[model samples]
Target chain A: MFIKIDFQSETPIYLQLRNQIIEGIAKGHFKPNDSLPSVRQLASDIGINLHTINKAYNLLKSENYIAIDRRKGATVLPLMDEPDMAFVDDLKKTLNTLIASSICKGISKDDFLTICSKIYDNFREEM
Target chain B: MFIKIDFQSETPIYLQLRNQIIEGIAKGHFKPNDSLPSVRQLASDIGINLHTINKAYNLLKSENYIAIDRRKGATVLPLMDEPDMAFVDDLKKTLNTLIASSICKGISKDDFLTICSKIYDNFREEM
Candidate 1:
């Protein structure tokens, strides 16, 4: 429930929240059927605008992370299986774009893979 | 330069452009002092709005990746060194947040690290 916001980060706040929540769910921090803090409460806790928190909630809803009940508030949904093929396809497209751009920039395939490997190794999480 | 836009990406288009340009410079696709396409031209080429292209250009300028000379248009700047400690620190903060959230969600540290290592090794590039 302790979320830090990097105001100066190039990433948008809503994205940060969405990613954090998704990661949280992936790691199993929130159990199925658990209730999320009310949007207003989360906004006050995070000290961000309500609209921003609402935006995150809306995104989560779209992704099926949580369901909104008119009177009961937002409740956590069970984590789904690994990302769908559509999501994987989207990821491939992004990586392909990045790879093509790197090639255009003169980054050899070897160097590009090396950098990514280094980053992955350096940041590997202990699961 | 041809840039593709994903209307459905969670990331902002401007950010995507900024990251792509930075990576491009790192890979040497653009030489020092190369001139970038004008906003209108780039927008037309990419099939995006002029304002979107302008926004990306503006962000690049702020990051010192490009120089905007009123009459001359946007010109690429010399490639900078590896990211500074400040940038590294920011990246660390992000990863730490992701790790902590994962831990909260019941992801084991070993598993996380293994996933990261696999990603790194799988994607490692040759210099």
Candidate 2:
């Protein structure tokens, strides 16, 4: 698994790690049932604290992105086919903020949609 | 000014307040140069701590969504016509995570773009 950490970024290291893993999974770098590196190994590889890596893993598990097994540790779960109502609501709330910020920044509707389309296409290509 | 806080939410209270204020601005409930309620007033209104509201206001100021004056307190700033390169980079990083999550949730490209278009249109209507 490939991961990069920017120690200087305002984003917490654990959250950054979580986002990178999700991006990696989306980009086809990690497949369903693929085992993730153990917390100790990943901590050494990324040169972060073991507790930070553990926090990231715990978050991922809670979010249903991955599952932990007694023997295999953490493995990626298959993509969910239907999002729950709560997930949809959360997505809308997030999009609301982004859209507001974009409008305030004077991003044209065409430009904004174009960016969304392009990003969506990038993920589609991986499918 | 209207604000709602869910104590049960996983997101921090300060962030929820910040996002709601941004959404309010985008929806035209808050015009450029409109004065926000004092931190004390808003905190009491929403029944949250004054410190939490202060934190949200400070973050909005740092993001240039609002400005703090000695006497006037925090006032909304006019939207910027040009986003800085750093802002664009941050926007892309956020979109990347959102797009990846959408893909993993089996949201089709059309559906995703439609959602984006609808939200952008909502902001456009307020202009």
Q: Which candidate ranks first by DockQ, i.e. highest?
A: 2
* Candidate 1: stretches off by over 4 Å: A4-16, A40-53, A70-72, A92-127, B5-20, B23-27, B43-52, B69-73, B92-127
As a whole number from 0 to 100, the lDDT of residue B43 in candidate 2 is 87
RMSD of 2: 1.9
How close is candidate 2 at the interface, in terms of C-alpha RMSD after superposing the true interface residues? Answer: 1.4
Candidate 1 docking classification: incorrect
How well does chain B match by TM-score in each candidate?
A: 0.70, 0.94
Q: Write the per-residue lDDT of candidate 2 for residues A1-127, one digit (tens) a residue.
A: 5899999999999999999999888887889999999999999998889999999999999988899898999999998888677777778878889988887877777877888888877876876
Per-residue lDDT of B1-127 in model 1, one digit per residue for the tens? 7456677987788777776675555445666788888999988887788898899999878756789999999988764434455544544545554543344334444554554444333333422
Task: Return the top candidate by lDDT.
Answer: 2
- lDDT digits (tens) for residues A1-56 of candidate 1: 95777899888999889877766655556667888888899999989899999899
Please list the residue runs of candidate 2 whose C-alpha ends up more than 4 Å from where it truly belongs after superposition.
none
Quick one: best TM-score, which candidate?
2
Give the Å error, residue B123, model 2: 2.8
lDDT of 2 by residue, B76-105 (tens): 999888777777778888999998988777
